[model samples]
Target: MEPVLRNLRIGRVLNEIKKVPNCMLLDVGCGFNHKFLSTVEPYIAQGVGIDFKVPNVSFRKIRAIQMKLNETMPFHNDSFNIATMLAVLEHLEKPKQILDEIARVLQDEGKLILTVPGKRAKPVLEFLAFKLGIVNRAEIEDHKKYYDLTDLQELADQSGKFEIVHHRYFQFGMNNFCVMKKI
Candidate 1:
């Protein structure tokens, strides 16, 4: 993703968390570089980042774990105030299960903030980012599917545990961000 777009998404997510002081967060698919955790550490009281591999370095407020999305999360029920899956849902084969798990781990009023590629803009991104070499092709290779707003809403509804609180298209409609509350 473009740096500006990535920052926009991250900034928006941070803004949401800022509404609640000293939040505890779960960051799914947080990569080995600890990029997201580093940015969020100072703001959050505590955080856990789970990915396929552990990060090389750890932050003071964040714990990194190596794990897959489809498997059961190690966390207990109602463990966190917020959960985030930035550009991650599309890469999971069993997204519904993951969504369910996210809901299971979040507190009753906890929020889920996520982003996925816009289905309608996939072709354009493929052309510009992959075909034209403007962006890294490998970065898009792991995506199992792209999601439109409807697909995301359906997944949230199917989870049977969350209610959409907010959603909108960002990055010129090439990406989507959604905030859901545990219900």
Candidate 2:
């Protein structure tokens, strides 16, 4: 399959997988596009993809379904070795709840990977749009939250369960990438 945004998102996950070996993996908010599945294919023992919108299950190869992120993930306790929340947290109303759920389903030593927009990207872009009056901040559905380095760190640190292992600016050229790992 040709690469796209989903592929880009999954690439980040695959980069992190090199640090851990032979693990079960879950991709939260994996959509019908399944653009990123190929990245994780070779490394993960088993991969489960979940999203709210129904994705084309036929091509996914891995297990997938339509499910809400705010609700419970349908699996046993400590079901996965690693869980990735790529570009999904900023869209939710209650991101903390989802983080809590991720913690509950992950093994004590399991890892969680999170990526969101960098601090200035969203606000600067949105502010540019506001000047033109072409977009309304409230109407922008996908971005429910924005984070600077400090705020993102706090969110990951105070998750109630997970400890922040690594935090840094993930970048692809001029674009900013915010990467956080659950410890």
Candidate 3:
């Protein structure tokens, strides 16, 4: 993942967050640095970041854990008020199941905000990664799928755990931003 592009995705997600004081947040695939969590620390009361390689430690109001997203999550039900998966949905082998887990851990009507490469980004991302050498080749190569708005909506629908609240294409339509409310 390119740093600028990852931050762009994070920015788009940030716009969707409703500045709720004391928000309990769950950030999936927060990477080793928890950059996004760091940025949103002020608005949230506390946060938990889960990733395959996150440092297993606790910060002031944030916790980082090494957790495999493809498996079941470790938290109890209704553990979070907001959950985010910035640029992460497409990397999962079991996207639907992961979405279900997100729903399961969220409080009723909690928001699940996520981003992924939109369908139209495929060729451009490939060109950037494979030819231009701008994006991370291994990262783009690892993506299992690209999603469109309908794909996201359908995934949310199929889980029967979320309702589409908002969605759009950003980054010049190369990326998708979706907000689903837990049902």
lDDT at position 43, candidate 2: 78
**Model 3 worst lDDT window (10 residues):** 13-22
**Residue 57 in candidate 1, Cα distance off native in Å:** 5.4
Which model is ahead, 1 or 3, in terms of TM-score? Answer: 3
Cα-based lDDT at residue 103, candidate 2:
78
Report the C-alpha lDDT of model 3 over 53-75, residue by residue, as the tens digit: 88898979889999899888999
Alpha-carbon error at 33 in model 3, in Å?
Answer: 1.0
Worst 10-residue lDDT window for candidate 1 reads: 53-62
The TM-score of candidate 3 is: 0.96
Each prediction's whole-model lDDT (CA): 0.85, 0.68, 0.88
Q: Output the lDDT of residue 113, model 3.
A: 92
Who is ahead in lDDT, 1 or 2?
1
Extract clashing residue pairs from model 3.
none
Most accurate candidate by TM-score: 3
Per-model TM values vs. the true structure: 0.93, 0.78, 0.96
Query: Could you tell which candidate, 2 or 3, scores higher by TM-score?
Result: 3
Q: Could you say which candidate leads in lDDT? A: 3
RMSD of each: 1.6, 4.1, 1.2
Q: Positional deviation of 17 in candidate 2, in angstroms?
A: 1.1
Off by over 4 Å in 3: none
lDDT of 2 by residue, 2-118 (tens): 135446656666888766777788888776665455567777777788888756364433777678877888889888878887767678888777887887788777888876766
